[model samples]
Target: MAAVSRWPENVVVFLYAVFFFHTFSSAQRDPGYTFMHQATTAPIVSYYDYIIVGGGTAGCPLAATLSQNSSVLLLERGGSPYGNTNITDLAAFGVALSDLSPTSPAQRFVSEDGVVSARARVLGGGSCLNAGFYSRAGHDYVRLAGWDARLVNESYQWVEKVVAFQPQMKQWQSAVRDGLVEAGIRPYNGFTYDHMYGTKVGGTIFDQNGHRHTAADLLQYANPSGLTVLLHAPVHQILFNNQEGSKPKAHGVIFMDANGLSHRAYLNRGPNNEVIVSSGALGSPQLLMFSGIGPKEQLDAHNIPVLLDQPLVGLGMSDNPMNAVFVPSPQPVEVSLIEVVGITHNGTYIEAASGENFASGTRTRDYGMFSPRIGQLSTLPPKQRTQEAIDKAVEDMQALPQSAFLGGFILEKIMGPVSTGHLELTSRSPNDNPLVTFNYFKEPEDLQRCVDGMKIIENVIESNSFSSFRFHYLSIVTLLNMTASSPINLLPKHANASRSLEQFCKDTVMTIWHFHGGCVVGRVVDHDYKVMGIDSLRVIDGSTFRNSPGTNPQASVMMLGRYMGVKMLRQRST
Candidate 1:
């Protein structure tokens, strides 16, 4: 709307050419990977049959699937996951999450409730950052979502054939499985991708060689010539055509490249041509608000013009609260993420991971980036505090070990967390994380479920199969027990005195990162994931799910992209 600043084309080309080629070495194996380019090279104006913003977990598969029949454009804010050892190598898993540097593949954000979490910033999205556990949504979740069952299964098969794998059962995982069954969690279901209430071995995205296969790998199925993926392209807003007598329609989108230069991409004028937002649960809602499609009051406060005054745009958010006990192993345990899991009938899930550098990856001092022109801020922090304070904080952070180290095992994670919260934009910038709170255990029912789950974990920890790995000597028992203060402190001495357990649940609540909703179905979007009262637009990511799909959602999420892409293609043909 104002004077447009432009970079000289030659300088733009030269700057990006140097940064682009050298960064994508790890991704060179994928044939379609060559199609990726820095957003700076994107044309000033372009048209596509579909413009999918956020080249993330769901976005990648959706783009690849749709490109088979239509021209598709995928815009991602982060660069390729390639050459990032923290993302690709399974052993180096937590490195990016703890890096916290501006260039890290996973960006850290703290909730208002004080739980620190990471948002995926690489092209493969959370798959590039997570523990790589893969499991399908339970039959109940599928039935509740009102999806076509056959199609959903087919979609799962489609994604699993490429990215999902049967992980080799390692020593630590096998013991955990035995302990869960010994604790009476369920009948052993052996290896399965289906979500069933039992101790079962699920799928993983990591191969035998420990190389992670993220959703980006699904691009191999794409019609390469028809798909254009631009990295370092963050969308600014969704452009709309507000015809006097018609509903507000998403027509195009404006995105900024690496240089912050704006480029516009529009949909081909067809009823079916659409713009999809697959920018995760938090990002999708934030994007909608930034694009002027959320609560009127909030938009007004942010000085953003409202095109559609949807009241529930960022409502009904929930992140499954995960509680864990670090059990130190006397012998070296095999390094593993979640390979074995116990799915309880009471709606809580149990899983474990061992041998990660829980202290986070060790980093060199020249990691972080900052601002205010402090003469080339090399080791600066993102906050505005003094350099001394940040240096101390970084030193403490590097020293901190959130989980057990030296081959210790973590009996971790509980799912559901029916407790909900909401997201509201702090500023109009899409890059800024919105104010969010999971409101963990706010509901009485949610608190009860957590108590029930913790009791199960107590049984598992006390079981014979698990005892061999734990320290038994009373001299050091208190230190090695689930809590340093008391062994099985989550349980009440008097059976019905549950208040202490409930308090413990509140005090130590953390996220398993299975958060979903915000642009929830029936509230923000319809059954088809079309945003209420909006046309030629849809929000199709974890944000639309009323519940987290399975033990882990990446598999279900990737499946959703393929499922919906095929459905849309069918709709177009009809």
Candidate 2:
């Protein structure tokens, strides 16, 4: 009685033509606003002098600057990067990061020590899955986050006058800006976005025909009759009230939509109504440790209900540790991604990205500019990691030879390492995915500053103005043999090849995903980004970054959502 197998009629007609073009396609677009669909039951406006929660990249410029005089809302849990084309096609950036589907505006995840990323479930979060490099936010990170260096340069020119640009530098990003001034990384300041120190040329959100431009196109400065947004919704918590202990405010949120129902909204009672969040840095500390706020014994070991012990809600996480050096090129260049940046006064930040015409059934040919040791060799389980140690590291990275010009370079150390990491709560399900660690190189001076940023990318590939490309420095100790049982001496006939290049930087370190501190600012938000003991709440993106600003944090997270929407419209007009 257990024999009903079937399927192969051309795999059931290619699974009914992929469920009839994803159930009769043509829907998702509309970022125009007044948008709805949390499976529409209408009613929803219970209040909202401001709400916001994650339309992403700092909730679409802080809900289009608090909808120009209050009444906002926003919401957004994916769906609507206005006409997706794998997010408006900038060479379909590896088909929007290898589309893991669930409506893919790049949401993959993975972590518990197996580090795989891809965050941004649409609505321009991580500027719709990053690489649209833009700089600024390093005047010692605005005098160590005391900000207001003239309103952070007027919120970096109001998000660089609608999603920045100025790139056009081809030929392998002008040989990585003349190999970072032939690796001396000196004064070639040029086209600045001002993080200064050396070879520049920043700002880019793709335009000039490459086409990206997100942060939901800054909701074209909202106020569409005081914004509303909604989309697939999803919030699921943060509706606090707490009386017996005083302080707990954040009066409303619950969420769920896209036909999962549940709604709620709230906020407009007064005293400057609030709720911000801008979900990022692993979703604003996993939605503030799933609303009860964190570390009260990891939110009572995930049984949840704490309300606010706030042990630094998801602690000081930090990322930016990259180290790639691929270089294939034999001809076909163009098709790029970050343009000319080298910043290094000994804290390394060099960058380069051009993967030449890669749109053939994308996974961008298993795009590996570091960070994919199959999530660190699938963190040990899987029958104790056999399968011939993952097919001899994928046959030694597919025995090299396959290139129609493949140049890629990323060497980010992004400032002296102080190493910090944390973010917990494995479950209490706001749709799970939480435990991220980034304890990368657990501070041995962050593996000698990522082996001094891989000897400044081996001195920009032994420059001579990058001698007409043609390259090959695979080496992460021959691409991860990791200097066979390293008991010292690691090549250059050892005289301490910097302790075998710090054990080949602990087997090729990763994450240049520039993740900032988890709800940080003076540790869980304060310096005007609110959230500390939670009242009207706040968090305006890059998880209120009190640290990672050495560079590429999506133009300092859209200048912290336009400097917290001009300091919440000057504290709601006083």
Candidate 3:
């Protein structure tokens, strides 16, 4: 077990929040978000010992760790996430989207299979948008990845010491815990970061003030002299030297600035100098495909030069298929985020959040997702309320009647889904979203797992632990177990299924946004995470993951960055 930091909890809530804001705004002092230099300001050419693509959840930590001893260039396509309440404050759900930055962090996309999902386009990546749940990857994951166990523990400790915190459990979350236990998940493993089968209160990245501490916050540990972070710099292509009788070597990358100006950054002349792609699952594969490293047939279709015919580059794509139900609370539920999780043995995970709004934890009754509340608006002065936002709010209010106000969400997502799909490039543009389809519940086992999970959820809703929160209908008999009138039923009466339970799972299928794969180990990359058939190139993000590890992948992804960095530094010394 890792030595869990006994760092004083009360001190961190305000200390880190204030520290991050003060240190980040100076814009030139640290290798932090405030030190964000626009790509246009960069020279037409530059050199670094390491060029890291994607300053995301894993990228940020990886680059920060590498910068301890080597000159590193970190490039992010999106802008900073410093002052955005929509992204930062846990209680404030989707208030409004600002034109504050030229690029917004949430890049919305619709997959080929007609499922709507959004990829993070900001510096902290999905960590800025996730539920902030933190749990270690399972023991099986460590053995399978062939990671050094002692170093893995140390890596997790390093990140936890800086970012992860024990959450102050809230009302809705507490009830969820009891309900999970009531449903017979297992013995409670209270207040733990270790992944275990049973109800457990895991660490959270959100502080007591409801402020989010993301993977980007880990940059505080970076060496300022050795790191240069560029924002709004999307890579166009990875420049490679493909000489005959040698493996293709990644030399540099071409990236576009916010001004749409192109710039080049190259790896310096050193045997160990490398270009690492830490872009998320989707972005990493897409970038490789853009740089002529995918299937030969797909490259020919786009007229791209084939650097490597790595057919497995964009294969084995899977998403933990998620299904959720809105539990309408008769009384106003206090705004709460995910603090409790149930690790069931049947390959299913149950977690939940409460709020008045569409974002994680909100409490409200009468507006669309973007509807601007007068009270919330009044908190800010007149100038802070942009005309665009008011107009958007008006538009939302007009569309408000069609939308339903949610009390809270209790969700179940299958872990390590057996049903898989693939990702294909949509166009040649690096920024264009590729076509991805998870084919949710396509396999019989997957469908059966979801159905079984839903049954557990139904048990949770009816359990004695949730009696206070449960809505009692004195007038009509509440038929929770009946197929005809289940409170958890989201599907129409006539949807195709052997029963309404399976139909409910099918109709309400959604993405928890835990999509991983495309560049999996043993297939696209080797055991060491170095890309096969290529030199001086490696992928260290969720793209290489065969599955989203633990309750959430953020902790493991961040840990992998630090762990690999330590390993590489040791290798260099030897």
Candidate 4:
């Protein structure tokens, strides 16, 4: 009996050795899955080579890449993605989307001062809960930012390989494809092989083995050597070196744990190492202001002591407005994962991966941007309400040129013409969440764009592809009446539409939560992603985008994060 007990003890020692040795081992082989089993706790005050804040879309990749050559500590504000009830399950995600209250980590960030904020709190940040759409921005948009076209294009390509984005080819089945074609929806052939602009094709897929690919999956491929992922570590403020004569340096960060305990991690494992803030659009800006890095007047109004007066830290706010037209399936199409998978396999066709082409040319469409037709509407003021304004908006959307083969297309405008919103400090208590007033649709022109977007949806429904389906023309009035003062409601006056399309157009508006702009790049941070007024403090996330890509912002965010990571690694080596 004594001998048997000794064998058990020896086995335990062997396992321990395996973990200890591999923890510091070379990057050639797989690291035992022991790191994945780490318990959620506040990070210890150990010195790390790099300390990345936020484990969301960009932060996850950033941490993973940096850790390849150095010790990295990633801090996240939410719990692990493993057992989160609201995240792992697909139906649960849909339920989360429909819920009025902000319960999911991503939804919770949208509120400020007891209101819903757009930032997310989770191990994977926005990627954990966002609609898994892997698409890129137009080349023109990148060139417009004064970026070398070749460099920007190369960056796009490099990141695409890192993520290994594979669209759902099976979703493009015969039945769905034939139905779309017969209904006059021209297929966008070679979308994955060439320039995606003007290519009318089916939606791309972002899942593997029927499971959605979140940031966690992307990080897994990065194979970080000495990276530690810390969940439930919400960053409240950035600690800056405020000595009068020295350069303003980012030394550490103040964070609160799930149980509300205070913790801090110095950059470079000291009071002088760099701090990378990948907290995202809503998150990074709020943190900057709290750390005294924004407009002086704005910070003072919120009672936040001034640390730096970088006026553009959170000023260039932007997001796409979404107004969805829900049309029930003609037949009871199963809404399960299996059914979605079956549809893909039998519907349209697609490539397994785009190889080199994945990095070049815009090859997709996001149901977010309010098609190019509604340009200049963002210049309107917030309160100048009028029906003529709405009418003009509708006309602009209707003018979007559609191929003769495709009857019409839906114009989902996420970035409205009116851009009005500001970031304000909600509390000086580092423990309290920052106050964010995204002010969605505060401008009348924004509301007008919503109305126009809906009109476009109505036109798309009129196409033959949907004609045979159980579809109905939702008059603008009916739409408003059905959902007024509701986050889901795009139009409010539709309740009063007198059966006339013209009458319906006079009222109704909606919003699509494709948020962007705050802490916008170029204006907020230097070209290398360092915060303008602070040394050794960099922000690489969606907030650093030069402009809201006229499509989904996920791909853009990921690319930017990857680029920043490469830049940081190069600088550190020097």
The lDDT for every candidate, in the order shown, is 0.77, 0.69, 0.76, 0.52
* Each model's total of backbone clashes: 0, 3, 6, 42
lDDT of 2: 0.69
RMSD over all Cα atoms, model 3: 8.5
Residue pairs with backbone atoms closer than 3 Å in model 3 (clashes): 27-34, 355-361, 355-362, 356-362, 356-363, 356-364
Worst 10 residues of 3 by lDDT: 474-483
TM-score ranking of the models? 1, 3, 4, 2
Better of 3 and 4 by lDDT: 3
Candidate 3 runs further than 4 Å off? 1-35, 94-102, 358-406, 474-498
Listed in order, each prediction's TM-score against the native is: 0.86, 0.34, 0.85, 0.69
| Candidate topping lDDT | 1
Q: If ranked by lDDT, best first, what sequence of candidates would result?
A: 1, 3, 2, 4
| lDDT per residue as tens, model 1, 338-445 | 898899887778888776342225433211111111111112211222445445555643464533343443444456657789998898777778888888777888
Predict model 3's lDDT versus the native: 0.76
What is the model-wide C-alpha lDDT for candidate 4? 0.52
Lowest-sum lDDT 10-residue window in model 1: 367-376
